[model samples]
Target chain A: MTDVPSYLSPTGQEIVFLLLGVVAVGAALLVVTTRQLVHAALWLVVCLGALAGCYLVLTAEFVAWVQVLIYVGAVVVLLLFGIMLTRAPIGRAADLDSRNRPVAAVVATATAIVLVTVVIDGFRTAYAPLEPGGGSAREIGSSVFRTWVLPFEVLSVLLLAALVGAIVLSRTDIRGRR
Target chain B: MHVVYPAVVSALLFSIGVYGVLARRNTILVLMSVELMLNAVNLNLVVFDVWLRDRLHSGQVLTLFVIVIAAAEVGLGLAIILALYRNRATVDLDRLRALAEFPVPSPEDADDHLPENATEETAGQASRASAATGPTRPPGRDDTPEATP
Candidate 1:
């Protein structure tokens, strides 16, 4: 903390990160505030992709790729499928927002103010010099296999359970035992 | 890179998610907002991991775990939403109030409230009566092909 870099001179990496962060935040705002149902999902793709770029700028290379693959690739598609299957209106409808928008806006604004203040106060001088290869697949894989194998295996089991649960819930033929 | 950049971005994203979850009427939209919130947490994890440079890399590993869990959650949630749409014929969260408790009518006003309660009760009773007649059938079987056709 004593030898922290001053905020007056930001490195190239910080500049790139802030740019990507702006894109992500803007797209995320569009995702929530968009009136069209399908358009919201598309905006979400933009938001997630920008976040992936942010991760790359942060030097978490492996996490960035995974974020792109899992979130931008699979999750957005799943959400689109959900929107279509539910027969959501194709064009903008007026009632997408509920009556609680004003209250929600107030709460969200308060949350943002408090969180931003706390984080800025706590980490004002926490500068991390970016180092390449620290977040590569080789490093993360070795760390995961060596130190985090138990949780990895448990997560696989959880994924399998969720898969089975989804199938059971969606299928009409699978009746529970009374 | 200053840690506050990612931290502040994540905080704002989370607040947007909170707003979407509170304001959206559609169940699927609510799910999207939840994903935003989860992504915000993931960003926080990755940033902290990079900052600390831990030997175990717990932050990145946990971010991976959170991603996997988020995938599972979206799958299950969409299934539940599909089930809800199938049963209720609409996915509007505000209208899905079957389990909401309605105030019981006081005896003094029972006479005037008869019409309103009658309408509500008959809808409940009709559904109940149908269930009573089909004791051998499985409950919530409306999606069955034979039942549909």
Candidate 2:
């Protein structure tokens, strides 16, 4: 029930994926553990960029670009604004960490082990060959509108709600002074 | 070469995110950690979308939805954090225990390192609040005003 992938050797793609994976994982590790707030944000950008590269290697071109646009371009820049607004310590600082690090490490490691084991066991030998035009924008758009209409619309509503909630929460009325 | 590579990498990213959330004291850093976790989930979705070879590309669609939702969450989360900082001065999670039965003084207070702007803004709010309440109004905290983690 299987055929060899003729497009290119899997090794090339695999190596690229591994490279991107290492970059993404290493940067993500920094994102959490960095004491400098701005450096943490920048590291998050690197992690996101590497994930986008992974998506490209997997042949999900649209998703990869969207990953860059939404994550590296938008979300991280927004996070930087948050840091500025809150006046987070710009450089390294010891107060950045809490005292529960040992507990955190345990929980995180346990979760990673469980998830990795499940994934490896479940998808051990499955392979899906990529065909050209598989992840074209037209294809994704048509499917998104036709099959996933409800969810797409619901997300639009959710975004609107979040927008309103944020504005309401942050309102500071000098008029209340009078 | 194994499909497991992407999966394992995603897992590592998610684990790091968990550690960030649990161990970081700053609110913005916590938000950044949440983003890391979300990105890990996106990686898994795309990897599987290609692996399953589904006709409709449901995995990628779902990833799109997730990205949009993550954006919405960050927008709202940052707004709330900004508001908290404006009111309380410091964005330290341990110090922002307003809901505790015995509220602890913020770390800024213990160290007497309250930012000058925080003090000024709070004083201005207090002065304005008091004038608005007037002598006839009790100095009690009303539901109209409140403050955050």
Q: Which candidate leads the pack in DockQ?
A: 1
Deviation (Å) of A61 in candidate 1:
0.5
Task: Give the TM-score of chain A, superposed on the true chain A, for all candidates in the order listed.
Answer: 0.97, 0.89
Q: lDDT by residue for model 2 over A1-178, one digit each (tens)?
A: 1753432555777889899999999998888887788999899989898898888888888888998999888899999999887766767787888778889999999998998899879766766555557777898999999999999999999999999988877776522332
User: Per-candidate DockQ versus the true complex?
Assistant: 0.71, 0.55
Alpha carbon lDDT at A161, candidate 2: 97
On the 0 to 100 scale, the lDDT of residue A94 in model 1 is 78
lDDT of 1 by residue, B1-149 (tens): 88999999999999999999999999999999999999999999999998898878899889999999999999999999987776555678865655622223346544533434233343344356555666565445442223121
The TM-scores, one per candidate, come to 0.89, 0.83
Return the TM-score for candidate 2, rounded to 2 decimals.
0.83
